[model samples]
Target: MNPTDLSLDDLDRAEAEIETGKRGMRFDQIGSFEPNAPSFLIQDVLERDSQAGVIGDSGSGKTFAVLSLAACIATGKPFAGHSVAHSGPVLYAAGEGRAGLVRRFHAWAKANGVDPLNVPLYLADRGAGLIDADQIAELRAAVRKVAQLHGVPVILIVDTWARALSGADENSAADAGQAIAVLDELRREYGGMTTLVIHHLGAADKTRGRGSTALKAALDSEFLVARNQSSTILLTATKTKDGPTPAPMAFELEDVFLKTLEDGRKVSSAWARPVEYVAESRPAGKNQSVALEVLKQLYAAQKQTLDGAGFAGREALVLVSDWRQACEAAGLDRRRFSEVKASLVDSGKVFLEGPHALLDADAVSGAASESGGTIVPPGRRTHSAMSEIGVSDAFGHFGQNPKGGR
Candidate 1:
C-alpha cells in the first residue's frame, strides 16, 4: 500500500489493525501527525494535550471564571480579553453537584445570546472519583458517548479536585500522583484533549494549592483567581509552558437574571466578563484598613510616583520605611505590620517597587468578592507540602510578587 495514497482515516484503521508485535509508529507515519498538535484552546493562555489548574479560596469567583472560559470555548467567544484559537465541545464535571453550575451556564448562554441546546457542552453534576476505577471507567464511557454524538470534546473541566477524590489521602504523593496519572491517561485518550482541574488554596498562608505538591507538578498551566480591590476578581496566568507568563489581568462577575419561576420569584446567577485592568485591586479587610489609614496619613504629608509599565496608574505611592514608621508610631507593632504588609503585597492590593509601595486605588472598601462570600483558609498539612517546596519549581513560578509581569 502506498503511504502517500492513504487518507488519515485509512491510516488510523491501518494503525489499529497492526499486530501487537508492531507497537510503535512507523517512520513513514510521522507525517500523519495532527498538524495542530498543540494549538491554543484559549488564545495565548491554554493549549491542547495539557493539564492545568485554577485555584483560589472559597467564593473567590474561580468557578465563575472557569465556567466563562468553558462557555467561550463551547461557543467560540473570546474570554477575558483573549480570543479563542480553537473551539469545540466541553465536558464539565461538577464535583459539588448540579446546584449553582447549571444556572451559571444558563446565565452565560443568556448573556451571550447562545441557545443552551445548540452548543456541544455536556455537564455531569456528579464528578468521578480519581482513585475509583469504576467511576473513572464510567466517566470515560460518557466522554466516548458524547464524542459519538457530538464532536470530540476539546476540554474536560473537573470543578473541585478534592471532591473528586475517593479513599485517597490527597497529601500522599503516591495517592495524589496516582490520581493525577489517571487524569493524564484520560486526557490522552482523546487527541488534543485538555484536562483542567479546579483546586483550592492553603489555609494559614492562603498561598499555593491546598493539596500535595505532586498535583502542581503535573500542571502545564496554572491560573490564580483572586479578589481585587474593586470588588472584582483578577484571573492571572501564573504559569505557561509555551511562553513567558502574560501580564496581570482582571475581570468582573456580573449578575445575570436567568429566568422567573412560575411562582413569580426571579432566578439569578453571575457570569464573568473581561473588564479592563482595574489596577489589580482589592478592598480592605479589617487589619488592612488600619494599615491603609496609616499609609494615607503618610501620603497626605508626601507621596512619590512609581512610574512603570505594570504599576497601578498614578495612585498613592509611599516609601515602605515611612509607612512602617507611621504604622509603628501609631502603636502598630513591627511584627504585626510585617504580616499586614505581606498580606497586602500577596493579594496585589499593595505593589512594592524598590522600597516603595503603591496601593491599588480601589482597595479601600468592599466585600471579599461580588458574591460577598469570603474563603476561610483550611490547613491541609497532609494535603499541602508547600513548606518543604521551593519558591520556584520546574512546573511554574511560585513567586509571591503581585506585579503585573514576571
Candidate 2:
C-alpha cells in the first residue's frame, strides 16, 4: 500500500482512534502528558479504575474468597491483610447463587460483628449480562440508584464471568471482548473504580481461566484461588500490573451457623479465614484433605437446602458421588476417593453413611464450631466495619454498626 492509496476515510478513522487514545498518540500531545504512579483502591490488590479477575477450579471456594474482598471494601475493613478505603459502596452483580451469598454474607457480618444490612452494599436484581449493551445500561441505572442512596460504588463485582456472558461464546475472543468492555465502561464512569470478576479455570489445564485468553489479557490484576496439597484454600496473586506481586494468602474454610431447621438440624455457611485463625483439630492426609474441603465447601454453600436424595432428617449433606467427581475434575486421582473417605471416616472427621457424606462439626471445632451467627436475608442491608489487624483479627471483632446500606 502506497501513500496515494491511503483513503480520506482511513485518515479520519486513524485520527479518531488517536483522539480517543485507543491507538496512536500524536507527538504534540506527548509533551503535555504527565505520568503518575499508580493509585490503588485496595493497596497492591486492585489499582484504581482497573479490572481484576479471581479465577479458579469449580468448588475451590472462589466465591468465598471474592466475597471476602468485596465485604472488606464495602466495610472499610482490611482485605487479606491489605489496606482498604471506605472508598465507596460495593455493587454485587450476582449472576447465580444469590441465596448462598445471602447466607455467606450473614455469616461474614456475624464473624466481624458488623450489621450486613447497614453496609453500603447494593446487589443487582437480575443477573449481569455483559455481552448485551441493553443489560449493561440497566446495570448502570442500578448503580446510579446506589450512588443516590449510598454513594458511588467503587467496587463492582461480577460473581462469575460465565453467567454474565449471556449466551456469548466465551471461547471466541470477539465475544469475550464484548463482555470485558462492559466493565471497562463502568470503570470509565468512575476514576477510582475497581471491577472484580469471578471466573472458573479450564477443566483440562487447571491453571488458566476457562475460555478466551482475552479475559486474562484485559485484567489489570489477577488472582488464582485454589486449594494447596494440604487442602488449605489459597489466594495467589498471579498478576499485579502496577505493583510487586504479593505472596499467596492461605485461608481455612470455617462454617458459620446461620440457623436451625424445624427438624432439629442446623444450617451453616462457609467463611474463609486466614490460616492462623482456624484451629485445625481435624487431621486429614493429602488426598483426604482436598476431598474433605471440597465436600465442606459444597455443603456450606447450600446448607439450608434439604437434599431430596439425602438420608431422612439430614439437612446439610453432600453426595459422595458429587464430591468424588469434583475431586477428580480438579486433577485429584479418582481412585484416591475410596481411601480418602475411609480415612476421613476412621478419623471421625467425616461421616459417610450410605450415599452421602457429612462433616462432623464437633471434630472440626478446635475452639468454637457453632457460633450464634444471625441469619440475614438478602436484597438490602446497611453495615460497616474496620479493624487494625490481620485478616483473622480484622474479621474476628464484633459490634460494628450499619450506615446507609441498600
Candidate 3:
C-alpha cells in the first residue's frame, strides 16, 4: 500500500479494526521515554488521567470525604492539608443521594470557607445508569461543555459504582468487569480526564469494595475511608500504582445551618474539616527532632524550587550535602544525623532515590509544617500498606502562594 494514499474512511476503518481486536505492542516497538513523575489531581490522593475508587462501609462518610476532595480540586485548594497539583471543573454524578448530597456540598464548601457558587463544580442528578451508552454520551457532552467553559480538563466523579451499574450483578465478576470497561471507555473518550467512582466495602471483609478483584486490580488508586474510635474521619490510600501510599489525613465534622422550618425547628448539616496538626505523638529525641527538621526544611525548599520549573509533579530531591548543611544549621551533628536519613525513609517520611532523598509525596514539607507548626504521630498501622504519619492544618495558603513563571 502506498503511504499517504488512504482515504479518511479507509483510515477510520483500519483504526476501528485494530480497536476491535486484542492488541499488543512488542517491547522493541515501544519507544524510549523520559521519566516524568505522575501528575496528581489531589496531590497524593488521586492522579490525573486515572480511575480510582473510594470504598467504605455505610455511614463511613465516604460521600462526604469524596465531595470534600472534589471541592478542593475544583477550587485549586488544599484537601486535608495536602496540596492540589492542579484544579479544574469537577463533574459529580450524584447517583444515590441527590438531595443530601446538595446539602453536604453546601456545608462542605461553606465550612471550608470556599464559595461554592463560583467554583467549577457541576452536579449530575440523573443517577447511575451511567453504565448505559446513552447516559455515558450525555455525561461526556456535559463534561465537555464544562471543560470548555473553564478551560481545564474535567474531573468526573461517579458516586457509587453499584448504583452506576444499576442492573448489573455486583458479585458476578464478568458483570462487574464489564461495568469497569464502560467506565474506562468514558475515561478515554474524555481525552484524558480523571474518573473517580465511589464504592462500598465487601460484606465479610472490610478491605476493598464489594466486587470482582478486577475492580481493585484495575484502579490506579484505591482509598478506604473509615471512622476511628475518636470519631475522627480518616482518609487513607490503600493502593497506588505510580506513587507511594500517602499517610492518612483526618477530618472532623463541623456543623452548617441549612434553614429553619416554619415549625421553628433548626435544620443543619455537618461537613468534614481538617483537624489541626499535632506534633508526632511519639516523643522525638532532642537530636531526632533536629535531624527530622533539617530534612523537612530541605524538602520544602526543594519542592518550592521545583514548582518554579514546572516540574512540581516530580519528587523534590534534597542532596546529601544539603542535608548535612541543614543538620548543621539546626545545631545537630552532621555525622550522627546521617543515620536519620535511613530512619526517615524507614518511617515513610522520605524516599532515597539515587544520590538524593526525595520527600515522600504526601510528607508535609518543612515550609508547610513550619507554617502550621504541628505534626501528629503516624496513624496506627493495619494489614493494609498505608497509615497516617502526620497531620497539619496546612489549609488557607493554597492558591495564595505566588506561582513562578514556568
Candidate 4:
C-alpha cells in the first residue's frame, strides 16, 4: 500500500478504537473497597454506593457541616465520628461567593492544622454554572483529569443545589425532580467518589424538604441541620439506608485564628466544639405522662362509640397536656409514662381518632349507672350487682368506677 493509503487505514483504526472506548464495558464483580473502619458509630447514617442530602433552613450551617465532612475526607480524618473509606483530593464547586469561601477555608484549615495548599481543594471559577448537565460533566471530566494526574480519588461537592439546577423552577416538583435526576446521574457516573449535595428544608416540617418530596425520596440518606436556641446547630439524620437511625449531633460556633503573626499579631481564639452525638431528650416531669393522659381523656370524653381516628385529631393535644399535668401530680418518670400510655392504647380503653382520644361510650355509661353518677376508672371490672341491675337508668348517671364504687 502507498504511504497515504496506509495512513488512511491507521486513521480508521484510531477512529474504531475511540468508538470502542466510548462504549464502556460493565464489570460484574466490582471489588469491594470497604474502608478500614467500615461502620461509623455516627456516620453509619451514610454508606458506600449511597447518595445523601444535607438540608437546613437559611443560615443553619448546612454548608459548614457538609464542608466539614469534605475536609475530613480530604485529610483522612473521621467525619462526625464516622471513618471514611477513602480520602484524597476534593472538588468544591461553590455556587455562591468565592471570596467568602476562601476565607472560610483558610480559617478552617488554620484551626484544624491542615495545610490549605496540600488539601488539593479546587473551586470552580465563576460563570461556570453547575446547573447545566453539560457544564457539570465538563467539570467532572476536569476533576478526573486532575485526579488521574495526582493519583488520588476526588470527592465532589455541589454547594446549594438551587444553584446547580437548570430548566426547573425551584418551587415546582417536576422541576425539582429533573434537577435531582441530573444529580443522580452525576453520582452514578462518579461511583467511586462521594458526592454531597446541600439543600434547604421547607417551612412546613422536617418531612417536607424545600422544592419537592422527590428530593428526599431520591436520596439514599438525608440529614437536617437545624438551629436550636439560635446559637446551637443540631444535626439530625432524617433518613439513612445503612442503619436504623443515627444520634443527633450538636455544635457551637467559636472564633479561631488562621495564622500567627510575629509583629504584634493577634490569633483569634474560639471555643473548639468537637462534634458529638447528643443523647435523646425525653419529656421531663409532668410532660412524661402526657401521652397516657391524652389517651385516657380521649376515652373518657368520647365514651363507648368513640372512634380512634377522630379522637386523635381533636383531643390528642389536650390529652397529652392533661397527661403532663397528671404526671406532675403523680410524680411519674417519662419511661413509666410511656409504658402506661402504651398499655392503655393496647387495652382499647381509649380509642385514637386522628389525633382525638375518645372514651368508650358504652363503658362510660355502664360505669356511671353502676356507680351512681361517678366516672368509671379505666380497666375496672363491673360488679355482679351492677350487671344484674342492668344499665337502663345509667343514661343520666356519671362519674362511676367500673368496679361499682364512686
Candidate 5:
C-alpha cells in the first residue's frame, strides 16, 4: 500500500475504481428525464423541487410580486386566486437592503394577520457583500440545518442573482452560466427544494434577463413582470418545464407595515389592490369620434409629447373626466370615454405616460402633426372613408391644413 511503490498504471486503476464505487452509491437517476410524466398546470403541481426566475424592469414590482408570492406560500393562502399546495418554512436571502426587507416582510405579515416571527422564515445574517462559492456552500449548509431543526423544507429566496453570485460577474455570460450551474447543482443536491432567484430584465429587452441566454435556458420556470394595459403590474409566466403556464396576474401596491393585534400577536401586512385587466375596445360611431377629440385635447394641452414616462402627476380618473367632458361637448357619448381612451391606448394613438394617456408626442408633433392634430375617431370612420384615405394619408392632409378644415 506504499504510495511511492505504486506504478502509474496502478494509481490510475485505483482512482478509476474509487470513482466507480462513488458512482455506484450516487442517486443519479433521481432527476433523469422522463417523457411520459403527466404535465400539470403550475397551479396543479404544488409540491416539487422547482426553480423560477422572476424578472422585470426597475419599479415594475418584481420584488413585491415575489414577496407577495412568498407571503402567500408562507400563509397557505391562494396566490392571485391560484391554489397553494404547500405551506412551509421559507428562507429569504436578502442581500440588497436588510432594513427595507424587514419593513416589507413586517408589513406583509401584519396585513395578512400572520405572525412575522412565528412563520418558518429565516434571513441570512451575512452582511451585504458578493456571494462566492463558499457563501453558496454556507447557505446550503444553513438551509439544511434550518430544515432539519424546524422539520420543514425551506424555500431559499435569493433577492437578486447579481448580489447572490460569488466570484462570477453577473454581466458576463460565461461567468453567469458557471455560477448558475453551481446553483442548479445545489438545487439538485437538495432533492428539488424550491429555489427562486430574483433577477433584473435587460434594458434592451425587458422580457429577457440581464445575463446570458444560458441563464434563461437552464431555468425550470420563469416569470416576467411589466406594466401592461393600465398601470397594473402584469406577472406572466414566460417559461415552464413541468407545469402549465400561469396566466398573467395584475396587482397594485397600496401600502406597507407591521401590525400588533389587540392581543399580544404581531403580524405583517401589505395593502395591495388586485387589478382587473380587460381587453381594450373602441367605442361605436360618434363616441369613437369624441374619443379622438378628447385625445387631441390632451395632446394639445401637453404640447404633444406623450409617452409612458410622462404624465407623472395627473390621475387616471381626472383624465377620464376630462375625456368625458370633451366628448359631451362634442355631442358624443360621454359614457364611452373610458372605453375610447382604452381603445386609443391599445391602438397606439394615445400613449400611456405612467398613469396618464395622451397622444404620442413624436407622432403628433412631427410630420403626423402636420394635419393639425386631426384624427378620425375610431368607429366614426366608414369603410369607404378608410378605403379612400389611409391613416397616414389623412394625417398628411390634416398636417397640410394647420387649422384642420374638412
Candidate 6:
C-alpha cells in the first residue's frame, strides 16, 4: 500500500512489524561489554537486576538474614562490613505472619541500633502466588503504588518461595522456572531492581535449595544459611554469577526485649548479631601436628558430651585431664605437647579455666588473633627445641578421672 494511501489497519500492521524487529538486535548494534555497578543493592552480595536464592533448614535464621539485608538496603548502610550501593524502599511480602514479621523487624532494628520507623521499608498486605498471572500483576501494581508513595525504587523481597508457590510442584522444572521468571519479571518491571527469595534447603545436601535444579540455575546468586557446631549462624555464598564470593560471616542470635504485656510478662525475640571471628590455628611441625590431632580429638569428645547433656555456649566445659589423656593416647612427646597446648591456648581456640579447657564458642573461623603471642615451651621461650623428656610437662598428666574435674 502506498504510504499516503494506507488504511488505518495497514498502518497498525506496519507499526507492529517494526516493533517486532526492534526486539532482535544485530551483532553490530550490541554494545561492548561493561561492568554492572561496582557495588549494587547489597554491594558484592546482591546486584541490580538480579535474583538470589537463600535457603536453609527451619530455624536457620534465613528470614532474619534477609530482613537485615532489606534494612541495610533501605538505609544504604553497611551490612556486616559489606556496603550497600542502592538504598531505596524495600517491600517485604511476608508469606508467613505479618505480626510476627513486624515484631522480628523491631527486634532486629533495636538490636542493630537502626530505627525501623525512619527507614522506607514496607510489608505487603498479604502474600501472592507466584504462578498465577493475575496475582503477579496485582502484586506488581501494589508494589508500584507503594514505591511511588515512598518516592523510592522498590526492592521486593519474598519471604519464602514455597509459600509463594501455593503448593505447586517445586520439583517440576517448568513450575520452578515459571516462579523464577515471575521474580525476574518483577526485577525488570521495577527498573532493574533486585529480588531476594527465601527458600528451604534439600534434606540431603543441605547446600542448595530444595526444588528443581532449574530454580538454582536461574538465580544470579545462591546463599546457604546454616548453623555451625558452635550454634552460630553461618552465611556462605555458594554461587555467584558475576562478582567474587565474599568471605563467610558468623552471627549469634541475640534476644532483644520487645515489651511487657498487661499481665506484666516480658516478651522478646532473637536477632542475628555479628560475632568475633577467630582463625583456626595451624601446626608448626610434626610435634605440633600430633598435638593438634590430640586437641581435635579431645574437643570433639568434649563437644559431643556437652551437646548430649543439652549444654551450649559458656555452660559447656571440658576437663583439662581429658586433654592430658588425649595427649597420652596420641603418644605426643611431653615437651612438644606442652608447646602445642600453649599455642592453642594462646591462639584462643582453647580457653583455660582452672582445671578445665573448652573451645571458644564465640570465636568465628577466618578471624585473625592478636599477634606476638607465640606459645613457647616453658624452658625454651625461644625457638630452640627444649626437648627434655620431662622438663615440666606444662600440661602435667593431672589424674585420669573425668568426673573429678567436672
Query: Which number leads on lDDT?
Result: 1
For model 3 the local lDDT of residue 70 reads 90
lDDT of 3 at 343: 48
Model 1, residue 339: what's the lDDT? 71
For model 3, the stretches where C-alpha displacement exceeds 4 angstroms are 1-31, 261-263, 276-406
Every model's TM-score? 0.65, 0.61, 0.62, 0.57, 0.58, 0.63
Compute the lDDT of residue 13 as modeled in candidate 5.
84
Could you give candidate 6's per-residue lDDT for residues 1-406 as a string of tens digits? 2459989998788778778884333464336766454547776678877887787889888877778778888887787788887788888898787887788788888876788889888888888579887888888788779867886464788878888888689888988878888887777767867788888977654545787888778877777776754677767666666544555666788889999999999988877777754444454566555655454444444333444444423232345555665565556655455556655554445544334454444331111121111222111122222121111122223223332332
Model 2: worst 10 consecutive residues (lDDT sum): 386-395
lDDT of 6 at 207: 43
Ten-residue region with minimum lDDT total, candidate 4: 386-395
Task: Give me candidate 3's TM-score against the actual structure.
Answer: 0.62
lDDT by residue (1-406, candidate 5, tens digit) is: 4569999998788788878785324456756966555322225433357666887877787877877777777667777777766677777777777776677677777767787777766777762133465676777687778878975553667788777665567767777666666666656776646777888877554446786777777777777776654566767655655434344577877675465789988755344455664433434355565566545544443332321324323221114344444455455554555566545544445543212334443434432353233332322212221111112222321333212222
Would you give me the overall lDDT of model 5? 0.58
Best of the two (5, 6) by lDDT: 6
**Top-down TM-score ranking:** 1, 6, 3, 2, 5, 4
Please identify model 5 stretches exceeding 4 Å from their true place.
1-20, 24-47, 127-131, 152-154, 256-406
Instruction: Give the top-scoring candidate (TM-score).
Output: 1
Identify the runs in model 6 with alpha carbons over 4 angstroms from their true place.
1-37, 152-154, 277-406
lDDT of 4 at 381: 24
Looking at model 5, report the run of 10 residues with the lowest lDDT sum.
385-394
Model 2 lDDT, residue 34, Cα: 89
Using lDDT as the yardstick, the better of models 1 and 2 is: 1
Model 2's lDDT to the true fold? Answer: 0.67
CA lDDT for candidate 4: 0.55
C-alpha lDDT of all candidate models, in order: 0.68, 0.67, 0.67, 0.55, 0.58, 0.65
Q: What value does the lDDT take at residue 374 in candidate 6? A: 20
Candidate 4 versus the native: TM-score? 0.57
